[model samples]
Target: MTDILVSEIMNRLNSLFPSVSSELNSINDYTFLIAVLLSAQTKDKRVNIVTKELFKVASTPVQMLELGLDKLKEYIKTIGLYNNKANNIINLSKILIEQYNAEVPLDRDQLELLPGIGRKSANVILNKICNAPYIAVDTHVARVSKRLEFTKNTKVNKIEEDLYKVIPSEYHTIASNLLVMHGRYTCTAKNPKCSKCILKDICNSRNKYF
Candidate 1:
């Protein structure tokens, strides 16, 4: 049952979203990480809007360090938690420069050790930046997993474990992006687009129909 469901979900999401790249392509690696960090409690659309200007000013660790805390805050003032996030960005930039030679570490452990990055953010970097097999379970991914009965747990780490238990490693990236996108657009929190959902037939969600 898990195998069949996973296969179907992958097909449907892949058909709708052929690729999940190009989201942070415009920015350098350091700026991309900053954008992802700033994305917490914020929308990607908003992040894009702010990053367009922020990246133009500081696209690297040294550049970001030179941008200063107040100026950094000003650039990302539109984002939620801008104050704290700006602090993390500055401190992390300093650490990256001092420790990692100003390069974003590819290792999850090293990356997580940096400020403004946790397990989920590290996982996202691992999957997207390093092309590693990691599925970062955000709120949308967790909701979709529960609704589909793909994961019985509500905790992000537990849900991620459940997904890894059943899902093949090769499909991790696609699966994560697909589930996140699906929950965002189709199987949303309110009034899910059941009629248009390809996985509706297989979905065990209680709120299937509008």
Candidate 2:
């Protein structure tokens, strides 16, 4: 049952968005992790805007530490939770320099130990940088998965487990990208474009709500 649903959604997503990946607009692990952390409760466009400026000044752990929390806060002031995120970034940068030799830890466990890096953020880092088969369940993934009947639970871990069970191993890397795009553009939280959605036939939330 789960496999069938996964196949249906994958097919529809492939047709809708052929090229989908980290639209956070980053090129390296450091930038990617920073972007993901700043993206908490913030939009990709905003994250991109801040990261563009932040990275120019501090792209490495050494540079980040030098920038200091106060300066970092100023740069990312537009993002949500700027104060907390600034502290996390500073602490995480210190950890990276002291423990990991200024390198982003590849191990998910180690990554999670960083101040701002949670399970989802760690998963994003591992999947994007280390090619690990991890699904980071953000708001978009959670909403889309529930609406598509992939899972009835709102718990992020449960949704991730269900997604792994349903989606094919081959598609895991692309699945995150595809689902994120679907949620952002078509299956939005408010006023979803169901009429324009290619998965209108399979999406459980479409006709049932409208």
Candidate 3:
């Protein structure tokens, strides 16, 4: 799609989904990071349920260590990949305490250094926590981007680059969340609600005209 088309799509998306929200809205930075980590391969709703109890017991790095690995696993065991998630959470807590003085680093690279944190996770933290203008490309965003012809590249980093190049800076954060919410609800994977979709005309997906 042309830059003008991409810009129009973002504008329409921002208008439809006005609020900036995340399923993992932790009270503090420490809990927020843990929530995001636990969210991998799991639904946000599920992650929120687990974190509500998990954070009540341990919201800080030191408290997490005190919670212990085995006990931590017990709390988040219902989540997918709980075993690996538990291990990473514990180790990452230690790293935060020992390296960053138990604070969530704002730098993308620094945040990515933590266990279970990758480019997507780091971008989320930077955008939500640091208020950086970054559009984190998750499964929903990636799928929506491809459908909208934002980029043909399946690689997430390249997709992000393509989005940034076309989308206005003012709509960076809004655009990401908009596409995510759209993909989550209207433009779903298996069966999209194209009839009710505002971007139906602009969408280049195979099912757009269906």
Point to the candidate with the largest lDDT.
3
Q: Which scores higher on lDDT, 2 or 3?
A: 3
Q: What's the distance in Å from true for residue 127, model 2?
A: 1.5
For candidate 2, lDDT tens digit of each residue in 67-136?
8888899999999999999999898888888999898889988988899899999988888887788988
Residues forming the 10-long window of minimal summed lDDT in candidate 1:
20-29
lDDT for model 2? 0.86
Q: Residue 34 of candidate 2: its Cα lDDT?
A: 89
Clashing pairs counted in every model: 0, 0, 0
Q: Give lDDT: candidate 1, residue 190.
A: 82
TM-score of each: 0.95, 0.95, 0.95
lDDT tens readout by residue for model 1, 85-158: 99999999999999989988999889889888999888877778777888888888888888877878878889
Per-residue accuracy of model 3 over 1-210 as CA lDDT, tens digit each? 777887888878877876756767588988889988999889999999988898999999999999999999999999999999999999999999999999999899998889999999988888888778899999999998888877889999999999898787888876777888989998888788888889888777847446
lDDT of 2 at 33: 85
Better of 1 and 3 by TM-score: 3
Residue 115 CA error for candidate 2 (Å)?
0.5
